[model samples]
Target: MSLEAEIRRLRELDWRELDIKEAGVWPWSLQLICCLLLFLGIFLGMHWYLVSPAKQELQRMREQEVELVREFRSKSLRAANLDTVRGQMEELEARMEALQEMLPTGAEVPSLIDSISEAAIDNQLSIDFIRLRSPSSQEHFIERPFDLQVRGDYHRLASFVADVASLSRIVTLHDFTLEPGSGGVRDLRLSLLARTYSYRHDGGGT
Candidate 1:
């Protein structure tokens, strides 16, 4: 058969039998629109409910990691500064120990007399007179010595001065005077010098 004849026969035979529904008219068009809307709704729902929150959580974790790194570096620098100060303190302590070892050992006597007077007052002794005098010069030892004059009843004065000599700071008495009392007893008059030494750390005279 010729091509023109075949075309004519195909066009004439199927006009009514092959007719399909029109896609642009009411029901069919509405169904296609509804399908498109359903797909769009599913995509938007997943993005709002699931994917967006996950992305926000990932960003928060990244920010926290950066802050922690900065804090760690600051703490490390402070630790290094503390170590340097500790080294300097140790050196100063060593120098203080050496100076203390070279100094002479002696007593603080004025402090001892003060302690004795305090004890005598606490013990209810009636002190009539108290005096302190300048120390005597001595060539043998480096010391600052002073004399104490005390007047009281015999027993109270003896006990007070004896207690003063027994103190830890090392006091030595050189002389004392006593007078006779009226009731077959003696009133005490004490004149005694006590000595102590102090060392100068700054190379000044002692």
Candidate 2:
């Protein structure tokens, strides 16, 4: 037969002659269950593998940030306290310098003599006499005045003289006298006084 004749015979088949079943709920329900299961599995896998770990890591980072903030606050407080202490120390040092300046400077004989007397009293030494004189014309560095003094007791006089030397003003011991004590111990008498000169700056006298 020809190809056209066969196609025409195939198309002429009756539709009512074919057997077809009605749609049932069982197969549709099974397909719906499979789809639900697939969706649920995807949700659980995402929670376990991705979402849960991300949440935990986020929480850990938040905790670390909080700790870092606390540390920063503590360090800032310490820095502030250090600054305050430094300011106080600077103030104290300035006050000390001011006090040092208030003391006698140069060529002031009375103040130097007073300091020596105080040293003698402090060291339990007896001052026989204190004499102060201006430097002779032949002396070097004549700007500073010259002072002389006499005292008694070996150890006490030595300590007294040392204390006088420790004064901020400049003093020198030019001469001394030693004699035997009542107990045969050597007693020393030192004649010393501090000397300071009139200091002159470019502007004026100091």
On TM-score, the candidate that comes out on top is 2
Candidate 2 global CA lDDT score: 0.63
* Model 2 C-alpha lDDT per residue in residues 1-206, reported as the tens digit of each score: 57676556556745455333532422344346567999999999989999999999999999999999999999999897998989999999998666545445444656677777788888876667765564433222334445445555677877776786677765555545455544335555555544554323343443
RMSD per model, one decimal: 18.2, 16.7
lDDT of each: 0.62, 0.63
At residue 88, what lDDT does model 1 achieve?
Answer: 86
List runs of model 1 lying over 4 Å from the truth.
1-113, 126-141, 181-186, 199-203
Across 23-103, the per-residue lDDT of candidate 1 in tens digits comes to 343243344656789889999999999999999999998999899989888888878798787888888889866645433
